[model samples]
Target chain A: MEFSLIDRIRERTAQARDDVRLGIGDDAALLAVPAGQELAVAIDTLVEGVHFPRGTAAADIGWKALAVNLSDLAAMGATPAWALLALTLPNADADFIDGLATGFAQLAQPYRLALVGGDTTRGALTISVAVHGFVPAGKALTRTGAQVGDLVMVTGTLGDAAAGLRLVQQGGQDDPRSAWLIERLNRPVPRIAAGLALRDCASACIDVSDGLLADLGHICAAGAVGAQIDASLLPRSSALLDWFDDDASLDFALSGGDDYELCFTVSPQKLAATQAELARLGCGATRIGRIVAGEGVCVRDRDGRQRATARPGWDHFAA
Target chain B: MEFSLIDRIRERTAQARDDVRLGIGDDAALLAVPAGQELAVAIDTLVEGVHFPRGTAAADIGWKALAVNLSDLAAMGATPAWALLALTLPNADADFIDGLATGFAQLAQPYRLALVGGDTTRGALTISVAVHGFVPAGKALTRTGAQVGDLVMVTGTLGDAAAGLRLVQQGGQDDPRSAWLIERLNRPVPRIAAGLALRDCASACIDVSDGLLADLGHICAAGAVGAQIDASLLPRSSALLDWFDDDASLDFALSGGDDYELCFTVSPQKLAATQAELARLGCGATRIGRIVAGEGVCVRDRDGRQRATARPGWDHFAA
Candidate 1:
């Protein structure tokens, strides 16, 4: 029965990738990484209630599972190559598996990422994805290279997913604009191309999985620098602005997580090229702030006054 | 709090490996796969109640979680390199985490397997491990090469784990030999050295996680051949024999899972060398069966008569 389910998944996710010497069936997958390229690997796990709402669609869960891991690769400026999924389901629900494979394939097809191997078990619903990508030696972006005075930039709008979550929790399912926000929450686009373009220009990079303020704080800690973001400069989707007050939307943009957008630091000299390159990729870059000489992350109002927040962002254990 | 836990884990498992350009604390780990080597990747998930009993020790869980993934690499004749762990717990318990990390480090230190990068989440306890290893190009043993008349072999004694599990389930924890059986269940050693030695000689190889009969059946199905095991020749540990009668012990040997031992097929010409090589590795190899002209797996009793069993092995969904 397990074999049959594996066969079903294999049939659905079949693709022609020569680099995958062996796919799903074997005890372990055989992959050939191009010579001189380093392999970038990341893993993330999503539980039914903790990561997503209890009743979230399996298709959305599948997409988000791979997207989160791919976002990690994107933050590293690596080109995704293969993924291994370890799926735990409450039962063998064929429809759920079909929906999940469809969603996973939809995102994977764009990057040509192969589902090389995985395991399925009977348990509480949990999805774990480990992605492998290739980055040219000495070229991967990291969160420890930000220097004082570097511009902190982000790709795409923030607060949409957080607003979407708010609408979801408030039972705003019938709102016409809710679809747009919910889509942001359910299907996030990993900034892979923008990351690749910023590989040489960006001094430091990270994905906004823990909200902008919290994630940027990581950069500050890693590079032993500080950052100050202008609240008014934060990018928010039209839907986010329309659904909430200015202050509420700004708060979400500041500390609401699950955006999956790339937040990077670029030196002033490379700012123009970085902006133009990301613009060409269709996810225009937004300059939010600058790396400073102090410690931790600070947010300033449009008038340049420091603003206080109750807390920076979500911490799974703390919450 | 999450960061502190991660720091604790990183400090405990720290090792200096030059190939690991970037380890934990990065968005993604950067690893260099030596030129002319293929990467072998495998993932496995262990959930509470499903993979292990409810009261199992955290240390045992951690050791088994990694051991299972390493066994997958061993089946492919790959030397362990690095591992990514995604640990989901009911809550953040420092003592539990410490115990688990200790168990994991105990197994990993021998192979020099570095704990690279991973995620920790809040949910029902689950440990998903993805292991990365390197095998020389074209040397990976797979399940597709078994030819007619190949000698079927397995490493280490079988059914001890199964017997151990039975004892645990039957409330025999206080028995004189229960500790020995329970140890087998908790810390089944992966035969990495034996698998490495069999790389050149074995036609097909797989790890026995789903009982000898079920796992061997996979080899037959993949190679499109048949197999017949001589029941009398099946290797049983003294503990398993002392715990159960001949019939029960033989049944456990054939269909009890979680052995984490390698099962391989070698041509008659390589049989002697394979046995000698594995014996030198200290685990030794046992010849229990051979590839036949037909399909499926059959077991012959001492009188050379075919014996029928109720089922092959454990299937998550089917069970």
Candidate 2:
């Protein structure tokens, strides 16, 4: 049973990685880290109903499972190289494995990421992926480096995934706008290239998995500084703006989770260069705010008055 | 929610590892792999009711979750280092986290295995652990190097965990023998010292998670060799021997899973040195078989006659 499942998953997710001395089918994978590099690792798990609604397509589950972890590497300015997956399911289904593996391989192939090792078990549907990447020593982007007066920037749009989740939950999928938003929720594009572009210049970096306010709050907490973002400047896709009112869009942009975009800080001096680097990758940055000498993230309205703080983002254990 | 969970886990699992540049507070972990060493990675998942009994202590679950993955690293002759945990629980209960984290830390502390990063999600009770370890380049043990004349030896005793599992299912835990057996089931040691000892000499190695015959069969399959074992020579713990008859004990020793002991092949030329190496580590090995020229594993009776093959090991996805 184990052999067959591994064979099937391998058939779909196979990639040639010269550094992976031994890939799947081994007790543990052996990988060689290139000289003069630090290894950046990240792991995330997706559970049915909790991470995604029940009956979500297996392919989507697989794609999102890997995307979220790769998003972490992207947040760290790491080049993804290998991943290990632990998939738990109600039972071993060939078609499910095929779809999931295909989806995983689809996202992994562009980065030359190899599925090194994984375990499959019978249980509630859960997928855990651990990613390993390479970054030159001393150059990893971290959340503790934000300084006062640094410009706060974000890659791509923010509220599309949150809007997508809302439309899917409301059964409002008839419109093309809904379709686009739903795709954002189901398939978040990890900004790996943007992370690379920001590595040299970004003062601080984090991936927005939880809403912008909550994740930015992490940067604030780490650096012992605060951030003030203008709500009027939050980036939102056209589809999201067309589907929701201004107030709703603003709220979603501030607190909608599942946007796998990079929220980073850059010294004011490097703003133009950072913007140019990101532009070359076609994922331009939007200046939403600046680092300030305070605590916790503060959102300012169009009138420059602070908005009343809402519950930051979706809390997995919130009552 | 994520911060609190991380803080709790970090408080319990913290170790002063200078190589971990950044840990749980960031988007991902940055770990410096030692110069001239390759990284070995392994992942495993445990689900309530499937991997362990529903009422199993959170501590045991925690210990076993990390232990099983460490067992994989042990199979590769790697020195354990950092780990990432993705925990899925039905609800956020403080006491459960305390017990689980305490248990996980208890096992991890001895190895100085730091918990670097992870995700906590809401779902059916499950724990997935990914371990990263370092092995000197080109010296890591693998399953594909066995020769036809190599001796098949296993670290420590077998059948105790399997026997213990049987006793628990039968509600026979009132006996001291049952108590010892259950402990074996709950906390099977991942013979790190034995693995290190075998690194220089063992031709092939695998961890006996799915019973010895089944796991040794993996070595055979990898090296395209066969094996023959004598039932009479199989090692069984005193508690296992005292509680079960010869036939039952032999069956458990042969096909009982979750042992987490190393089953490896050593050449005849290195037998004395290998024995001395393991004896020094206090996890003495016993030789029960040898690799042969052809096909699947064959069992031999005490009388030197062929015995019929039984079904091999536990299959997680068996229908």
Candidate 3:
């Protein structure tokens, strides 16, 4: 079974870049990184009953597996290069592995990332993807460069994924809007272009996989500064708000994760430049907060009431 | 359990690098590449019951999990930089996770790799480590560069892992030398230093994980040459021959997998230089064969008899 599944995966991965000197059949895949470019790498794992609901579509699982890792490269402002896949499934079904690999290859085609070396084994359904990308040495965006007086901004909408998960949890699977939200949860459009465009203007950046407040906390902690978020400034799609009540929806927006939005900081002096840059890139950027001179994070409502946010984040080892 | 395990991993990774601006605590690790270097990245996954035996020691498995990916970096002739660990366990246990993290931290410290971003979820025990290293652009080692007259060399001994697995399968726990073979099986070292030294002299390089014959077959297939292996040149520890008869043990030595040694090729003219450089680095190099103008690999006995080598290499998807 493992054998047949591997064959299917290998067949599916036959489409790759010319620079992939060695692909699936070797101990490790060999790739040709372009000269003068640093490779950016990131790995993400999704497990049954944890990262996704049981019985999720295999294709979506495959898509999410690559999507999340690509999101990391996007946050780093790097161009995609190559990827390695590690998959563990209960039984090796040729069709299922091929389906998953097909989804991955399709998504990777646009970015020119070649499928390289990987391993397959027997276990619960687990997909781990390690993706490599290229960026000029000094241009790889990091979380340490943000300053105290920078404007905190996010690309795209938030809370859709968290709300989508809730809807799936409640067994709400048939709404028209549910498709959009579920797609947001399952197939996030990694803001690769927006991140690259903001590379020069943004002080620091992160991919929002752990909610807005918590992810912003990372930038703040890395920069050793405080952050103040205006709840009114958070971006929301009408599709998200129409499905749930105001407070519940806002809660989802504040603490919900899996957004894959690029939350970043741009200096006050670079605001005009950043706005112009985003316009040229045809992406939306909303200023939701500001980096401050203190420590910790604070959020305030439009009515001047302080909004209390629990540690609304995912902890893998919290029993 | 996940939170504290991550904390322990965080504490253990402090020796990684100052350029790792944010490590272990962020959504994604932030790093700064050196001014004029490219990054090489690789990922590997190990699953309980599939990749390792049941009831394997947590410490050994942890060490091996990082070691295998490090071996990939070595194959690329990249110096280790940073690593991200994605660990999945059936149930969260602080002691087990801490012990595993301790093993990984201990191995990573010498390589200057830091624990970066990771994801934890509930599932069968699996560890997927994605490692990043650095090399100057256009100088990374590859499998396609081996020329027709290159001398193929291997680092360290081979087949002890197969012998060790035999003992474990037979439930033999009392041989005076049994521990040595068993430890070899449990902890295969990655020849990072040897791989680094071979970067300049080696035309093509690969790590011997899936048996020497099968792995070198990868180089031959990629380099479009046939290899003539000297069976007598195969390295086998004396302890590995204590129980098995000569023919059986020799067969194991020729085709056994899980020996994580470096198999590389250098031009015949550079053979003496290769030996001198390896000696300077205190690494063992055994000339096992030479590449010829054909394709595939053939192993010949001392008298030049064509010996039959059973294909015992691992195939990830083979039934």
Candidate 4:
């Protein structure tokens, strides 16, 4: 039954491309790389419980599965070229599987990422996707390039997705604005163009899948420097403020996860040029922090004093 | 806790090449690709009950998890390049995770597949890996490449892995070769080199993950051709005979899966060249079948007579 079910899905897809050289039957699939380009690769896993609710909407599950993987490629400053999906479903539902595939095809078409190969089997519901993108040799974005005295910047507003999760947990009624926030939670837009644009000017960059503080800590750690983010400089969306009380507002921005925005550092010398470049791309850049000579991350209010507490972020194995 | 865990792992490994551009602690890792190569990517998932036993050795589970995805790249005729591992352990087991990493690093050393990025989370026992490889453009192997009348060939021997699984499940006493076959069951070496060797010669290719009949049926369906497999020519290891009597022996050879071997088709004119290439690589190739002009797969015995059977191969969800 599993074999037939897989066969049905495979039957509907196109066979291996002429250039594929090898496809879904052997120990591996092969591809012919065109001359003069390096492959950009990324992998992400969506477990039923860890990444999503057990009984969430199947369509949204499929959407987020592809979205996160694309987010990784975006962080690399590469244009998504191809993807392979590995799915484990508890039961054979032709409709559900088809719908999932439909969602993937729709998302991929916009990015021009072809679905090349994969494997399927019966198990707890899990989805893992590996994406391949192409970039000119030596052009990818990395986390180690930042230098001391670099200005920090981010895309999109923080804490909205986290706020949306709270609303869903609290059973927020179906209001239009809440729906938009929920949409942000379920369907994150990978900043592909923004990443491509920042490839040259940004010294070091990363996507804010983790909280702003935690994700920025990564940049500072990798670049061998300290960072100071001014709390006053943090961007807040009115929707988030409306949803959270004063005390919770800061917490949401500081500790929230699942915000697929880009946080990057550029040389202080490039500050003017950086703003000009970002404005050309029609995205605003906020100076939230600067890289310093020492290590560890520090946060200060407008008055410019350090406030210390336990680490603020999500941990997979948190008790 | 997760941040510290990542920091520890990063510290343990030496810094990567200058081309790494960026490393851990960022939202995404960055890389610089050398000029003139295309990337091949694949992903695989191992669930507790579906892919392996609930209590399989942790080391073996880790080994198989990466090996399976590596096999997918091998089938594509690409050189292994990089990998991202997403692990969902019930809880952090420093020793177990270390062992798993060791298993993966050991296999990867031979192929030079760099462990670049991944995420860890708490959930049911599951391991998902996405592997990326590189090939020249238009050189990837695909299931749709088979032409009418291509000679079908397989690597190494079949049925050994199946017999090994039976030994493990039934708790049989040790045979001289028990360890050998059990190892094969636990860690099937993907035909990485053999796959690359055949890139220029084979028209269509696939890995024998499912039973030979079922997997080959995929090639036929994808290539829009029929197949005739010579049952007598199918490679049967001597170790396989110990598990089943005469009647059931055929079943193991035909339907027993998990060989992790390559099954591919070459033109008759190229068969000699392909065989010579395999010999040069110290690999084995068995001429077990031929692609035909019609639909469905047929089996032929020593006398060249077709055999009739009510069923063929293992079906995961078979009632």
List candidate 2 stretches off by more than 4 Å: A1-9
* Candidate lDDT values, in order: 0.89, 0.89, 0.79, 0.74
TM-score (C-alpha, index-matched) for candidate 3: 0.85
Question: Which residues of candidate 1, in runs, are more than 4 Å off?
Answer: A1-9
Q: For residues A7-124, could you state the per-residue lDDT of candidate 2 as single tens digits?
A: 6656765767779988887889999989888989999999888888776778888899999999999999999999888899997788888788778877987888888888888899
- The DockQ value obtained for model 1 is 0.87
Candidate order by decreasing DockQ: 1, 2, 4, 3
Lowest lDDT sum, 10 consecutive residues, model 4 chain B, at B1-10
Worst 10 residues of 4 chain A by lDDT: A1-10
Q: What lDDT is reached at residue B298 by model 1?
A: 95
Q: TM-score for every candidate vs. truth? A: 0.98, 0.98, 0.85, 0.88
Q: What is the iRMSD in Å for candidate 1?
A: 1.0
Model 4, global lDDT? 0.74
Task: Name every residue pair that clashes in candidate 3.
Answer: A2-B317, A3-B317, A3-B318, A3-B319, A317-B2
Candidate 1: the clashing residue pairs are none
lDDT by residue (B188-241, candidate 1, tens digit) is: 788889888888999999999989988999999999999989999998988888
Local error of candidate 2 at A129, Å?
0.5
CAPRI grade of model 4 = acceptable
Best by DockQ: 1
Encode model 4's per-residue lDDT on A293-319: one tens digit a residue: 988778886678875635567776777
